[model samples]
Target: MIETIYFAGGCFWGVEGYFQRIPGVVKTEVGYANGETENPTYEEVCYRNTGHSEAVKVDYDEDKILLIELLNKYYQIIDPYSLNKQGNDIGTQYRTGIYTSNDTQMKIAKNFLNKKQQKTDRKIQIEVKPIKNFCRAEEYHQNYLEKNPNGYCHINLNEANQYSKSHLTPIQYEVTQNNGTELPNTGKYNDFDNPGLYVDIVSGEPLFLSTDKFQSNCGWPAFSKPVEKLNEKIDTSAGMIRTEVRSRKADSHLGHVFNDGPGGSTRYCINSAALKFIPYDQLEKEGYGKYKKILASNF
Candidate 1:
């Protein structure tokens, strides 16, 4: 079935760009929704306070694009916690929102929010409202990127695989490109219970060892810290969030950093997508002999 979802997250220009490139999204259009005006102009929405949010309408096949996945990708593009602005665009027109057509979408959006709430203690200001009205944006706004590639956009894809500096397997590319997390409790070293090394999936650079790993029960791989100096940290204060863990070298979204570690120390509960584990036995074979010291001593 053809599925439709309305996403409003700051300006709709960059947000529309992201969905357009996604594999399953059939079409995307910049528009206005949930507003109290008729055929509001850009200037009207911007300065006149027509109450219309700059929104994007996404059309996709259900078999191709899952609503939940789209929502997640949407979160990646916009600041979910930001109240009334995205990037330099300020005012209510740029608020983060999701306008659904039915109960199924309502449930999906709510469940996704719930998952975020469970993962982090942040207050979610992303609105989940019913589809009131959708007005197509002007002709100049449609397919803005294809027509104008150099147009300004605040959203960026900081690729982790870019730091690999080498070609990787398709699976590695999937993990790195899609920000895919590994399947927890199913990896080869998930329960090895021995000194091991976690390497960058694309670059094979040694990152963490078993000594640095802690059980966070996050269902993916969990690490208390990096081995040392392998990953650079990111200051996510721009979005009003405190801090996030991103690979400095590869620019991969490893995961979030939290103060709620098993102990008092911070936990870098990373996604398996950001790592490849090499046990002690395969350390030398994997060219990670430098990390063998982790096996000799426990930190």
Candidate 2:
């Protein structure tokens, strides 16, 4: 299913460019929103004292990306604490906001804001309200960054391509999406030992630690325990009872678990395609920096 959210983070040029690179984002259009006037133009909204903020209307597939995840990514670029500005662009038109059409999205948007408040000492100045009025920006403004490569953009586009960097192969998508199993002993981390963290392929949620990995000789990565328990349920299908592992955030189908493991451990035999490894050195860049100290202590 597809859902739409309007994000106003300073200039829509950079905001639209950022989300357009995301995998699940279906479409993006620059526009003016929550203004008093109807059919507000770029000139009127920017200089004529219109209340509209430069915004980007983002449409995305919910199956591929969660609203919470997208909201988190959006916050990475903007100075939510700053009022009526982002970088050198100082004006009310560049104010940050999250405009939604319905009550459900409004709740999620506010919840995201509340969590963000706990992280910083500075007050969040971004607005969260129901969109009262909206109109598309001019044709040239729709994809300003794409058309003019050297456009004025405050945010780095790399922030939005983190998930794209872990691009999946055909087989990986088949296993994670279709719930298929990889052939035994052929997995990448089956016998490999490295001090790092493993994350979900789709949502990038941390799943396992190298410290918990044990040599069960099971042909796949054998984990004595996950970093934390995954949101999975027991599977009793095809007349076979097994504890199936699944990514709760991304809803991707991982592998199953078994009791026959080393050290009297409950083995979690997971598929390589369902996971992406973040090396100890790159953990900080991958947003799992907290685990670096954990790996160091274990080492």
Model 1 C-alpha lDDT per residue in residues 4-98, reported as the tens digit of each score: 99999887877776666554565688999998977888888888888889899988768645898788778877777788988998899989899
Q: Write the per-residue lDDT of candidate 2 for residues 125-190, one digit (tens) a residue.
A: 989999878899999998787667678989887665455546677767777777788899888878
**What's model 2's lDDT at 37?**
92
Cα deviation of 184 in candidate 1 (Å)? 39
- Model 1, position 13, has a per-residue lDDT of 73
Question: Alpha carbon lDDT of residue 216, candidate 2?
Answer: 76
Q: Candidate 2: misplaced stretches above 4 Å?
A: 166-299
For this target, which candidate reaches the highest TM-score against the unseen true structure? 2
Assess every candidate by TM-score.
0.54, 0.57
